[model samples]
Target: MAPGTILLVDDEENILQSLSRALKLEGYKVETSQNGSDALNLLKNQPIELMMIDVKMPQMNGLEVLSQAIKMHPDLPVIMMSGHGTIETAVKATRLGAYDFVEKPLTTEKLLLTIDNALRFKKLQDENKDLKDQIRERFHMIGKSKCMLELYDKILKIAPTSGRVFIFGENGTGKELVARAIHNNSTRKNRLFCKINCAAVPKELIESELFGHEKGSFTGASKTRKGKFEIADQGTLFLDEIGDMHLEMQAKLLRVLQEGEFERVGSSETTRIDVRIIVATNKNIRQEIEKGNFREDLYYRLNVIPFIVPSLRDHADDVPLLVEHFLKIVTSENGKQPMVASDKAIEILKQYQWPGNIRELKNIIERIVILFDSPNIDENHIIQVLPLDGHIKKTRFEGKKPLRDILRDVEKEVILLQLQRNNWHISQTAKDLALERSHLYKKMKQYNIDRGNNSY
Candidate 1:
């Protein structure tokens, strides 16, 4: 490993030479500066891990230098040294964010110990800032709709705790996105965030996938394998499409939730873990329990805190923002100059029923960016590229309709498209349309759309 870089600042040439030699001998990279300004300039040009500065210096005092250094690199640790050291000066240095102070006559052992502790603290702060940046990039949850604002508020409030989050939404409605937001905002953000698609795994393999498998446990089990639970210890584990999990697996899952312990496949030994569980399902788990497809106990265990992700159609006001964001991403990826969609094109997009929610919208924008060469893409360009299906038919009113009536028609069409995409699950349909279950039911009644209870 590379040695940690230390910037030593002192006006006394003899002291600088002596300390530089001793730190170098102790396996640290050292740089010397006679004055505060030169040290600040060096810090700007190069990455300085730590700074050791004499308290009394010409031109700029050591405390002023320390304050400026912190402004530039808050995580950088600075150790103040003084021959005329006093308790008041040490207290002042500490208040100014100095890591620690040393007497002028420094012993090699004492100096090395202080440097080690300061470097360790700086490393921890850097790691924490990097993790925060990663979370912001990955789980953006971009939107400004009223419903989106509410969801954001809920996530901020619940993320600090270890509460189990149950996300309810339709396929492609960004359920996984919400789960990630919670994980990234939680206290265990630095730890692993493991995910498993319960619906994607085969019924027989789910146990092995969640609780690891011993050697010779199954057909392909040549070696012992760690499972999602073990990998996510001290972090968060996201279980996607949980409502589709097999009834038998649900029983095992309930047991694990009740007691944070599970035995690996084909092994008698039990392992315990500390993991926060977050589950997402595009199905109505309550209805599944009623239909004997899900366990009541498991449902309750996972539903400690419920979060519903609204689909693109439900938040029509955000369509313009999403369109711009997609345009930026697609244009950058294609290495082309950015393009803008015309107002007419945006209006057409807002009116259309997004069957596949935000995912479909993203794909459509990418296709348009690649195929069309126009600077200003209009409604005609959109119509040409969009898939030809029952959802995109043009309509003309025989007579002038009220604005409210027109909007209601648009809402009805969008809801219908999402219902078809989600196979008519009311809970999933509501999430896709950004509506509450109660609100969707009222709208269904108003629109005279007859969906039987057996749709799920």
Candidate 2:
């Protein structure tokens, strides 16, 4: 079978016939045209993956034809041929969008190789485009509420700048989504958009993770490595859970922001990078500063463009739209029949306070799709999947309690909520909270929280 179709365009009949026969023998379906005008007609009318055209054609020459063909199909690869080949003519063909220029009498080996390379290059380009399309679709924001509209406006305004962005939002409220949207719209969209969870990395290794270390820099440094900052050069770097960074690391980060450079761990050589920083944290930055948990100078430096992503509970009206969107995505991914929710079921979802925000809501929709056999979901399905303690508990700010104590109370409530959602399964709850099982157990012990004592 022919690998792909190729169009052969030349004013000379013998050259066209010879090249057509050669390409046919090489497993390409070949079409021959004796003039530039006929070649352009064939290009417009046929599924030609590649075109080999002569520069010294009669009426409309190869360069002229190349320009029109490019306009017609910008991705089609064109090769120019001429027995009277000159650097001037070759350069003109190239500027006019010829993929390559070859002198005739063309070598079959070289011409075939060029055609094969062009086809492979086009295939790679198409695949890259398809992958990017899928990413854009997956990260797309779905909402038209007043808050969402305002967010969209802010993203558009900030996307064109090179400012440091500090996003304030709870976990699972899509802070990462906001960062990606900004990067995709920015001038550096073609470059990398690297990310690191500041809290996820161990404190001992966070510096190495950001600045990269030389070979044999430390105990387990097996090979030289480039860090997030180096990898994100000429691109955007998203730092999640910025408030959780230790004070010493914060000072190092401040130095990088101030000087646009850093020395990798155990190395004296400094590496400079041009990276746009975007940081996010669910913690209150001002409170962290007051408590001496975060650096004041670093906060000011990173807070150039602050965005407060509204919590899902604050925008309950968008619940119906969110539910429908998640339902379609989940059903399609799971190869299940399309599912819709009853009006009453949607109302119940809207009324419930989503402690875990949009992330929790998405999980419930997925659970319903996977566990239930019904094509249409009703209130019972929603109720069964929702956490038992669906209501948000009001945290009482006692005047006599210290600020730290009050913060602890809120943290305990959050842990308890996640535990109930996971049915007191420590491992699952720990995973949900982005904590190691041992750390979660320590928190449970610190709060004296026990499943037997507290009823969901």
Candidate 3:
């Protein structure tokens, strides 16, 4: 295969021929353009990795072509060459975004070296851009609603401290994401982030999982093991589903929280740890404490820094963004081309109650990408997946409410549905709903709708 594609642009035929031979000899595919105008045409029509344009050309100068090309592909690499080279010309080329400046009477060796350097720099730039994109995907929270913005502010505030945090949310509301954001922003980001699901582990083995156990401590204890606390020493430990931890284990955990130390299952050797604990639970801790299933003292300690991750329904305006993000990720991971979610499909999604939250949204996207053959996922696809018995439409006619109250609910539903379908464009929504813009704004405030985000 050719090393890369290069476009050689110069008014001189002899210079073009020599340069083309040199590049092709080094296994590079070369395209020749006699003038800067043709060079710009090639750049717009095909993929050219690097371009070498003579500083002095007819109709269009090298600097003019460089400026236009950079505007089209800001990351592209371009070099300028001149036989009548001067210091002023080199500086002008640099300001015009030329990758390098090469004097005419080009030596084969020097020419190849400049090309190699330009390609290497471009590759490095592309790699850095991809790395930044991946970091954003991993750490950036995905919602733009009022609640999510508040949650982001809280994470930023708590991330630098060593305070114990208690995150409360419904299932699949991205609580783990909050915990990760906290750890990623903290000083101990380079250290371990240990997590264990309290509800998933058996009751008898929970202690061994949290605090280490010695060899032969129990029937299945074949070897000495380090628990999550030890592994996460000087790091962050995420306790998922903290409400399911046994009442007996809660006391032991409380002792560790208070003393910053714990003993192995079979050994009296106490180990001290400097772990920042961030625990999450879908259940209400107060209710758990009232039932005598959780320690009130432990609850108070963990609740020092409280966070609530809003459910998907609470921020329905964010549904379109979440849907598009999830679809791109799912389709790419499965080695398939990305599919589009139509506006009507997004409206249907925004109407959903999403008991399972973001997790359910992701699953639904992946399923559609796998099962549907069409590139455009429409409202019918969403309707097929969503449950028929839902609350939004169901709550409208409940309890034989008064006529005025029923009309208010109906108006709120109609306005919200229109706003969502328009991706929160206020003027367009009002026009589509046949309401004046001022009246629409008044109704939005009366219904307490804050059109703060989701501008698409």
Candidate 4:
């Protein structure tokens, strides 16, 4: 490592020579100046890590020089030296950002220790800043709730290993965010983090998408293409909506998980790869397996490490923090002034059920922030901006209907509203209502809603 540079400023020639020799002998690059003006001038051109300045000087005094040096190099540590140093003077120097103050006839050992501590503090500050930047760049998991803290702790513990994580949550509950967090904090952070939406791909193309395809494999196959598994080799492959995958695809995926080898479509050549798999689904995999929609073997293999993400409704206490975070993000992006929510608005938000979880809350906050003209968002503003169902008008009557029936009615209404808003696209509507597609289909059938006429 390169030696740390130290600048010593004093009006006395003997003091400068003695300190310079001592510091040089201690393996530090030393520079000396007789006055504050010379020290400031040298500071502009020299890369000094620390400065020791005398409080009493002829031209520019030590305090003024310390102030100027801090403005030029904020991270540089300044230690004040004074023969007639008073308590008030030391306090004032500290207020002006001096790292430390030493009285006249300073002991070399104490001075060296102070310098070493200052350098270490600076290094720690730099490292913390870097970590914050990296966190901002990757996941937007915005929450300060106890649940979020626990989730963060889990990520720290599991990210360093080659564990196959099964993330379970409601739709839009940030399963992908959890997966990405694991990948970002893992040993393969530098490699690709690929995602495949199992429900979005057609049944016929699912095999080609997962295990690659040779040239002329099908009508549109003009050239060889790598699948998500190969693309995410040595990294993380996130299988989202895994419960929606076809039965045949599940069998093929099971084989890959068991053997770690696969043959491309229309090709006999088998390839092997080492991949860390992370599967996420809103659907209950055990239930799906019981229903014969999902493979039991695959479910067992992927359920090695299960992480359950809490819904926004479960952590209602964090709504205000999440609202503030979303408001700031939206206002900054739109170049608008900051806005605050009124107490009534907060109460209204807390009263409503957030079926869509964090993603829904974020979208609703952004919508309100963009449309409302008032600086203070009140209950009226929230009522007008959000959809009608956001504010429930009826209270439960136990004697009139069964609790389960009433709950089903409420769920059916919320699902219908979300379906209408999303133009009845099953996948999108399911996401907006925080339900799996199969679950939504079953609910629609139960409610006698026609999917053909309401199709997106």
Write down the lDDT of every candidate, Cα atoms only.
Answer: 0.86, 0.88, 0.87, 0.85
TM-score of 3: 0.60
- Where does candidate 1 clash, by residue pair? 314-433
Off by over 4 Å in 2: 1-14, 20-48, 53-74, 80-103, 107-110, 391-456
**Model 3: per-residue Cα lDDT over 140-176, one tens digit each:** 6788899889988899998999999999999999999
Give lDDT for model 3: 0.87
Alpha-carbon runs more than 4 Å astray in model 4? 1-138, 390-456
Local accuracy of candidate 4 as per-residue lDDT tens digits, 1-456: 345999999999999988888789889999999988889899999888889999999988999999999999987889999999999999999999998999988778887787788778777877877876665554568777899999999999999999899999998889999999999899998788899999999999989999999999998999999999899999999999999999988889999999999999999999998899999999988888889999888888998889999987777778898788778878877788898898768876776677788888878888887787677887656665666565442444346788888888677656755665465678997887778899999999988776443311
Worst 10 residues of 1 by lDDT: 389-398
How should the candidates be ordered by TM-score, best one leading? 2, 1, 3, 4
| Count of backbone clashes, every candidate in sequence | 1, 0, 0, 0
Each candidate: RMSD: 12.7, 10.1, 15.2, 15.9
* TM-score (C-alpha, index-matched) for candidate 2: 0.76
TM-score for each candidate, following the candidate numbering: 0.66, 0.76, 0.60, 0.58
Q: What is candidate 4's CA lDDT for residue 264?
A: 92
